[model samples]
Target: AQSVAQPEDQVNVAEGNPLTVKCTYSVSGNPYLFWYVQYPNRGLQFLLKYITGDNLVKGSYGFEAEFNKSQTSFHLKKPSALVSDSALYFCAVGGFKTIFGAGTRLFVKA
Candidate 1:
């Protein structure tokens, strides 16, 4: 069975500071990790993915993530944060059904 865990329900950050949303996963075989964001009354949008290659993967909206196999962790990171970046973030691991974490709400304040 594949599963994902997002320990925090919400993360708060200042508008200009760096932000991070943590994610951990467990899978039987080689796994595919992905990050998605959802805005109010909107569908989930793909942020980034770790298929195979470099450990550091960059994605839309100046977002990036590090894939750590030994730790089984895929933590999302942003160089600089923006108020517009505040949203519901989900960490997912692809396998059978593509299990998703409960979601972490990010609050960016100016």
Candidate 2:
């Protein structure tokens, strides 16, 4: 069974502070990991991906993710949160078909 779990339904961060949205997964072979952000009534924007290589990967909007194979986790992070960064975030795994977690709504207060 392959699946991704975003434990948090929502994450609240004060502007300028670092933020993190947790994610964990289960897969048979090496997984194609991805992070995407979605705004109200908009399509998801690709943030980053972990195919195979370095554990730490950086992506758009100053976002990054650390892939922990032992823990089966790939957590999203940012140094400073922005109000504009407040949006829905999703953790996904790619294989025969892409599977997405429920999603985490991030709120960056101004």
lDDT of each: 0.95, 0.97
lDDT, candidate 2, 1-110, per-residue tens: 78999999999999999999999999999999999999999999999999999999999999999999999999999999999999999999985689999999999999
User: What residue pairs are clashing in model 2?
Assistant: none
Give the runs in model 2 whose Cα sits over 4 Å from its true position. Answer: none
Q: Give me the overall lDDT of model 1.
A: 0.95
Best by lDDT: 2
Q: Candidate 2: deviation at residue 89, Å?
A: 0.3
Provide the lowest-lDDT 10-residue window in model 1.
Answer: 91-100
Q: Against the hidden reference, what TM-scores do the models get?
A: 0.97, 0.98
Q: In candidate 1, which residue ranges exceed 4 Å CA deviation? A: none
- Please state the error at residue 100 of candidate 2 in Å: 0.3
In angstroms, the error of model 2 at 19 is: 0.3
